[model samples]
Target: MITRFEELDWQDTPIGELTLRRRTEPAVGQEIYEVRLGDEYLMSSLFTVAEEELSTLGLAAATGDDLSVLVGGLGLGYTAVTALHDDRVTSLTVVDRLGAVIGWHQRLLLPVSAELVEDPRTSLVEDDFFALVRAAPAEGEGDYSAILLDVDHSPRHQLDPTHADLYTVDGLRSLDRHLATGGVFALWSDDPPDEDFLETMRAVFDGVVAHVIDFANAVTGGTSSNTVYVARSRTAGEPASDRPSKAGS
Candidate 1:
């Protein structure tokens, strides 16, 4: 049986500080927050289908036993928790730009995120994801097997305007430099990415594909779809592209 759920006043929660209004409910015994800023639905703490898709696709493309990964965002620790499920993953570094978000996980969401955060395989960092990727070792220069990014809504729709750089040709090229040989870069988006972004991935990596996931709200039974972009590093003997194209030009 489902327990009776309570909605905390939006003015009393951390989610309220980051978003305009917040409402929470229980789904399968887990708490899910539905936050809205103006008319836009930000994100939630439960039923993370895109995060699962990123983890599943990232692990499938990984090579070797001691696989290292970099997660670009730490939303509710869903992706991090999912990544920790694989025993082959030796190290996982999660980067988040907001300290308050991290603090929320520690104080309020610890019961849900504690296992992954305390696990020996996890390391959390507070920084901009773009800076982390840019400062990482050069392409074919590190041990990272996968770089999973969920920084923005999608290439076509961004939560923040600055995130548009992440889908640009230059941005993809910079991201390509941090990947180990045969390593994969997986990105989660709220909608299917535009063709330009797909072509940008093709220009930088040897293999590129898109995976679609349909998410159903456990409480409301409403459905929504998201996409994951998977790109593998060029093999030793393969040639990589260096050309830059205008976005959707």
Candidate 2:
């Protein structure tokens, strides 16, 4: 049996209907928070291993002091909060296209929401992550120390159709322009590693690593897995187009 603590917040978005609900699991006596996009579940507090790792591994490969990070999605506040846990992260900008998702955190509708808002280093940005990343960088300026992106399901399958291009060589070049020297860019994928996507990352960044994350699913009573792709930027003069193309390689 389950008990709902508050009325569900539902909103119609350009993409679909977004809903936030709070509940208590009587079986375990645990408070649970969930976010759903239409009929599909976006995130749940119960499954956070991969979301947390998106930050852990993103910063682990980053080489810098007082690192500034940009998290692409604010789902359940797991990735943003995890990044703040690291002492090296001086600041984090959590960006999402959906204002409702950001508002849920602002209104404390979710359990992890408070932790993200209370942290001085954390700033909630309500904007499309792709648009922000693709914008041209200011002259003689670097944007972020690390970028942890979980906006889509995977490189091949995107929550939005426009995201598919971002996984390609031309699209990755746009993101590479904003990274600081040796900065890391990590992506979380629901499916296993894709060779084409890995090649695209390799062509754009210097160091590329694909991590397959495995965790047990209590609801399904079976093992589940996700993939994390991490890559580091190169110094000046190494433009993405200059490198060998993933298609040719």
Native-to-model Cα distance after best TM-score fit, residue 245 in candidate 2, in Å: 16
Where does model 1 exceed 4 Å of error? Answer: 1-16, 19-30, 34-40, 108-111, 136-142, 218-222, 240-249
Expressed as tens digits, the lDDT of each residue in 1-249 for candidate 1 is 454444432333322345422334544565455544445566676657778878988788788898898998886677888888889999998888777557655655433467776788888888888865656565554557999998777887776666677678787777877878888998887776567788878877765777777778777778777888887888877786454322210
Candidate 2 per-residue lDDT, tens place, 1-249, comes to 657565469999989999888777564468777888999988878779999998998899987688989899998899899999999999888889999889988988777789899999988988988976678877854568999999898888899998777888888889988888788899998988888788878878876778878888766778898888888887777655444423210
For candidate 2, what is the lDDT?
0.84
Which 10 consecutive residues of model 2 have the lowest summed lDDT? 240-249
Backbone Cα, N, C clashes tallied per candidate = 1, 0
Query: lDDT at 103 for candidate 2?
Result: 91
Report each candidate's C-alpha RMSD, comma-separated, in the order given.
5.2, 3.7
